[model samples]
Target chain A: MTERGLLIVLSGPSGVGKGTVRKAIFESEGTDFEYSISMTTRNMREGEVEGVDYFFRTREEFEELIAAGQMLEYAEYAGNYYGTPLTYVNDTLDQGKDVFLEIEVQGAMKVKEKVADGVFIFLTPPDLTELKSRIVGRGTDELSVIEERMEIAKAEIDMMSHYDYAVVNDKVELAVDRIKEIINSEHLRVARVIHRYIKMIKEL
Target chain B: MTERGLLIVLSGPSGVGKGTVRKAIFESEGTDFEYSISMTTRNMREGEVEGVDYFFRTREEFEELIAAGQMLEYAEYAGNYYGTPLTYVNDTLDQGKDVFLEIEVQGAMKVKEKVADGVFIFLTPPDLTELKSRIVGRGTDELSVIEERMEIAKAEIDMMSHYDYAVVNDKVELAVDRIKEIINSEHLRVARVIHRYIKMIKEL
Candidate 1:
């Protein structure tokens, strides 16, 4: 019997190297995972593919999906619609491929309410000092903006209690290795194996 | 700060290759784990090293340890006492080393009650048919004994629900790989990180 794929929710505060760790995982084992393409009302960039990068939709269409209860989690940020579409995730899982959802903490909590069985992983910085330096090093935000992000990060780190696992992003490669181990071990959970045993016992 | 070592309880029914899988893992990663040495009142066989194979002890000595609350689990069969020594396990863990306890289902459950935080893993044969064949293949027991073992296997398989993880021993390498992943990922659990965060936040 084919086992259903795992749904992994990876979330972290800003500047925590979630992107770098995820990228390393994909580069290391590309075919084993499928990235969940989100739906958005924002304009697509030049290199972004239609279905691969995101499913671009109008505000009205996105709202209809929300009304129809098709979006797993959605949020309006700066007047732009961004949400996860449930069908694509379900389809990929039904095909026996693991789905990776990289979302923010708030959206992660929302997804947890719907998919209680999904593995929720919180990626964190090594320490507050390192987190501050990373934010300062990015050079994309002003000092005030960086301070605001640090505040948000503190709040998000408090939510680590809600997650099943926490990986400190000390090194991107090491963090990716830890996440891969987590995925491997979760597949061996007893709840996932009992069904197969039931069938075997019946046959016996 | 030094993280506490993990205590893993690995149990399975007869003919499930638990020993083979464990031996493979130890051979693969010799320095990463410590095997819990058991204490037994039975006579030591030739070539059996004391403290390594078993801490050969008299019935009086074993009973004294049991009365002292030093034995994690103990049972008497054929007028011989057999049990796991708690001090060895705790001392090894105190030094920040993973401890592997290979015991029966009942013993594993006993350890679980004593150490509520240990990881429990149930290993099983690929199928009932395979399990039956393996028992018969051993040629150490009669037909009636084999039948009784099959009945016991059914009961133990039902107890998988009480375990945290289950691995099918279809291939020794694969089962060892799964167990190794479980150990690695368990270190990344959220609860383990929350304490560290609390200290860091306080210093900040």
Candidate 2:
């Protein structure tokens, strides 16, 4: 039996740029991990691919999965359904390939409860002040919207206690390095080693 | 407002080179951290300092600290008293300096109970076979002594689940980087960040 791969949960406030950093990690260290494509009812936004960026699904199908307990964690937001597909994540991890789930703090908490053994890492800007600047710099939102996000950021920070670790997105490369380090460190863990040992003996 | 430093506990089986790695970290990173020198009744082993290396004390004094709850954790191994002093660690952390206690697994566990807020990182060799080779390669020892050490190592691996993280001592640079990442990743934590804010505001 192969030692199972780690299930990584990435969460933070909306404007913390977890998406950009994760994208950078995928583009560069793509071989290190596979991203978990969430199932959602939202329409294809801009350059998103159907099965790549997200597993675009109809409301009826999503509800079916939800009702069947096939959704690890789901929440309806902004008039659309979004959730982690339990089957794909469980299958990928069972195959011994590390997987990533980019999610919100609330959803991350929910997923963590369902998958109690999963690792949760919260990504954040260098500080709250920087987070405010980044949200404003996005330029798509009004000042009031940014202020609203700042409140949400506060709630996000408060919810961070649920996370196992946190990485600051000071620089993409550095953050990615830390993220990779975390994954590597987890592999060296004692439990995993013993699990590998038991299988090694069985094969011997 | 300055963020409070994390209370970190470093532990591993003997001959894992935890002390050597810790010394290298101090040399490279300088003294921004509080190296909690444990108190002991063990005889002065060559160039060891009284307070710097350890707090050399009488057996009676060691018992006194234990009775007073001044010691975080301790053990009597090889007929000598060895333990971590609680006051210095708490004081240094209160002053916003990161504290590192290089301890055995038992002592590390005790610190964990007191400071569950602390980060615990266990250091280990890549594999049990490698650990055997490393122990024998340390010096010319009898095969039985090597076997005894291996048994102890196996026990440590058994208790590895008690640790929060593990760093593989495959290479010096890699181990150092992982340990530093553990420290840095901890700073991004919301509990520590919010505590810093509260403490800073209280000062004003």
- Please tell me which predicted candidate would have the highest DockQ against the true structure: 1
DockQ of each: 0.75, 0.26
For model 2, residues A1-204, the per-residue Cα lDDT tens digits are 565889988888777878777787788743477798788898988888887778899999999999999988987754788889888888889998899998777789889888887778888777656776877787777778777776777777767767777787899888887777677666665556655544323332
Report residue A176 deviation for candidate 1 (angstroms).
Answer: 1.7
Question: For each candidate, what is chain B's TM-score?
Answer: 0.86, 0.84
lDDT of 2: 0.77
Q: For candidate 1, list the clashing residue pairs, or say none.
A: none
**Weakest 10 consecutive residues, lDDT, candidate 2 chain B?**
B195-204
Cα lDDT tens digits, model 1, B72-188, are: 987664367778988889888888888998877877888888888899999989777789898788877778987877787888888888899988888998888888889888888
lDDT of 2 by residue, B1-204 (tens): 445568888888778888777877777762468788888888997788788778899999899989999888998754788899888887888788999998877788777888898888888776666777787887888899878877777676666678777787888777877787667666665556655433322332
